[model samples]
Target chain A: MSTVVDQPVARAARRRPGALSLGLSRGALELKQFARTRPYLIFTLLFPVLIVLIFGAAFHGDAGGGVSWTQYFVTGMIASGLLATGFQNLAIQIPIERSRGVLKRLVGTPMPRSAYFIGKIVMVLVVSAISTAILLAMAVAFYGLALPDTATKWFTFAWVSLLGVTACTLLGIAYSSLARTGRAAPSMTTPVALVLQFISGVFFVYTGLPGWMQQIAAFFPLKWIAQGLRSVFLPEEFAAREVAHSWELGRVALVLAAWCVAGLILCLLTFRWTDKD
Target chain B: MKTLIRIFRRERAIVDAVTENLAISVRGLRKAYGRTVAVDGLDLAIPRGEVFALLGPNGAGKTTTVEILEGFRRADGGEVRVLGTDPRNATPAWRSRVGIVLQSTGEFEELTVAEVVHHFARYYAGADDPDKVIDRVGLTEKRDARAEKLSGGQKRRLDVALGIIGRPELLFLDEPTTGFDPEARREFWGLIRDLAAAGTTILLTTHYLDEAEALADRVGVIARGRMVALATPAELGDRRNAMATVSWQGPNGPESERTNAPTAVVAALAERFGGEVPGLTVTRPTLEDVYLAMIDKNAISKEEAA
Candidate 1:
């Protein structure tokens, strides 16, 4: 029974595909899976838009600096949408995948581990972009919100969204380690997400927030995300109504950039494919 | 003891000469979870194209040992190799040559059977045709069905399809048929035999003694994180040479005797009866009986040591 064939030579001759192409393929599969999950669609994409409409209806007067409450809330909704799709979604989804053995199975495969993350990051980007576009459309149709008048302001919007999404996605991956099971994931993550929104002026006026609350929100990316978006969507004089007394675009870029770095570090330190022994 | 020493020396000599023919090799493997020793100084060697079964009770370190070989966990101390490469230093090429049918996986409820298989195929450089692999596992009729909708046996077949799609030289089956019905188990055994015939080195871990006896070319019994016995199923614990029990219907009722020469005993009984021995039967210790004896003896010896 020693009919051992020397298959190593033959198998080694075959070439492995590059990680980037495989990552893209994984991304496509992730999108297909996401589309079929109804709960993810309803909560991640539509739930924030629903909140924006309710808040828009409740506050009819101008918030300050001639920016109507609806417009102010629209900008806040975009920031909140990015956080929900990137942070909230991934924090819950990674734990669920780990609990279901998906991540452990992938760990044993020949697939590059980086490709898995790339696929997830790609999914978050696509979902965030779609939700952002929907919020923008709703703002235009219902709130009489004006588009950014210059390419520079559009550039600001692009960087802010990209930085905010990247930071939140990394943080989500890190936080998923705290959830031991899929059943516990939502209960663990939702409260933190809600607290960030409440404190970061997503559901209220930033200038009206108390000093201690404003100071606390300054440490997080969501605050900077909303402030940056407001700079793009609101008139130039609207800066006076901001707590900073200026647009503070430089500080916004700096704070969000810092979060991206911190989040990546945390993800590297805490990420796991399975429960600890 | 002499035969064991000779066998050990022969295996050690082979290890020094050519490791290419050995699909898996481990020496002095050790692992611990805090103070609990999971695997302690265990050694194993499997030659190429052999189906070897690891039999043990739950928490006997079977999972710890397999996980170490699969590179899912690091060993505290040992030399381990799979497919001629250290799993600790395993590369993508090394990973591509090995397949693992995990004890439980594929909750791909949203994806169809074909989609799940096709998706996994992309990870391997020398993958088999997904459709043909699916058909080989006897899931052709349910190729388009969602994974969650498949019955337990069908789900296991899908797991097998994914395990073989990579055309692995060595495959690890971790309790592959734990939940299978009798008929499904027979079918799964046939699949294993086919894979073995195709020259795939298979390492099977199972709690079922019959499963090990049916599929494994050689079985290794593990107790308390140590390999207590290694032999072919029929020869384990010297069962083939053990005395047989001959039972017959006597004038009183029934009678039986244990003897090394059962044929002579039967002949004598036949002469006394002037024809045939009524209800005569002969039996030897079954594999299960021998396995339980071995485990029980190991436990008693450990108690004595303590």
Candidate 2:
């Protein structure tokens, strides 16, 4: 029974593929699965646009330093969109995957463990980019906002958005380790994200908040990301409304980069592929 | 005595040959969760292309040992090798040769069965054809159906399909048929037999003795974190030498006696009843009976140790 059957099967085991291709396929499958979920699709694509429209219409006057409320609100909602797609969504999705045994099943496979995480990161980036583009398009079409006028401003937008997404996604994966079950994931993640959004100036201007609140907001990546986005889209004179009456682009970049490094270390230490207990 | 000697020689030769091609080997394996010892001083050796069934009661460390072998958990202390590599430090190349069917169903919400199977196929270098594997598991009809829509048995079949799609040389089945109906279980058993026939070594942990008897070439019975017995299904608990029971209708209605020679007892009863002993029957211990006895003996030993 052994000799006759062993030869063919052993010969068939010789063809191993590259991990990159496998990761790409996994990313593609994730995107397809996400597309099929109606509620998540609607929320991720429309929530930011809804926030921009509602806030832009309600606050009709200028925000500060001659920047119209519509422009300020558009940039803030874009930052909020990035946080929603990259951090909040992943923090909830990962724990649900663990509780459902999907992550456990993936761990049992021959796939490289890094490939699984890379696939997830890739999916988050792609989804966030799509949602960000949609939010920008809505802002430009309905709110009379303009796209970044110069290549330098576009470059700044590119790096700032990429760093922000990477940092938030890593933080989300790290935070997912705290969730014990799929049912508990929303309760675990939503309150924290909501608090961060409110305090980091997603819904209001950070400089107008109290001194203590501004100090606290300076520690997180969201505030820096929002400030960076404002520098890209708002008028140059609007920098007067920021802290110390300067754009502080260098400080924004440095803080987001530091958060990216810290979030990566936290993710490496805390992210669990399965529910071991 | 001559037959016994020949059988002993044959078994030794088989062991010697298998030792050179062991798919899984363990020595003095120990694992504990905080204060509870799950596997203690456990030893095992499974040969290539052989289906080895590990039988035990709940919390007997069967699952823990299998998880360690599958590289899902690290052992506290032991020498362990699966597919000639230490699972604790196994590379992705080494993992490609091993397949695992876990006890719980894997949930891939909103993903079609074909999509999930096809995605997993890309993970392995020389995976089998996903459509063919789907057909083999009898899920071809539901290939495009979402995973959440599958029945319990269908979900199990999908698990098997994924486990085998890699064309793994060593497959781990952890209670693969736990929720299967009778017919589904028989079908699943047939699928396992086909894999074994194709020279895929299988390490199975199951609570069902009937499954062990039907599928395993050798069965290891574990209890209280230790292997109490290891033998072929027919030879477990010395079932062949164990006394059988003779029963018949006597003057007192029904009579039964335990004896080494049931044929002799039945003959005496026939003579006592003139020509025929009404309702005469001879029965040997079933696999379940021997298994229960072994468990009881192990429990007593554990109590004595404590």
- Provide DockQ values for all models, in the order shown: 0.56, 0.54
Off by over 4 Å in 2: A1-8, A12-15, A180-183, B1-19, B248-255, B272-280
DockQ, candidate 1, comes to 0.56
Residues B1-306 of candidate 1 have per-residue lDDT tens digits of 999999999997776567767899999999999989989999998998999999887888899999889888889998897887778787887888889888677578778899889989999989888999998998989999988889988898888888888898899998999789999899899999988888899999998999998998889988888888999899999999999999999999999999999999999999999998899999999889899999899889979988
Candidate whose lDDT is highest? 1
The per-residue C-alpha lDDT of model 1 at residue B16 equals: 57
**Model 2 chain A: ten consecutive residues of lowest lDDT:** A2-11
Q: For each candidate, C-alpha RMSD in Å? A: 4.7, 6.0
Considering the two chains of model 1, state its CAPRI-style docking category: medium
Q: What's the count of clashing pairs in each model shown?
A: 0, 2
lDDT string, candidate 2, A63-86, tens digits: 876777888877877888788888
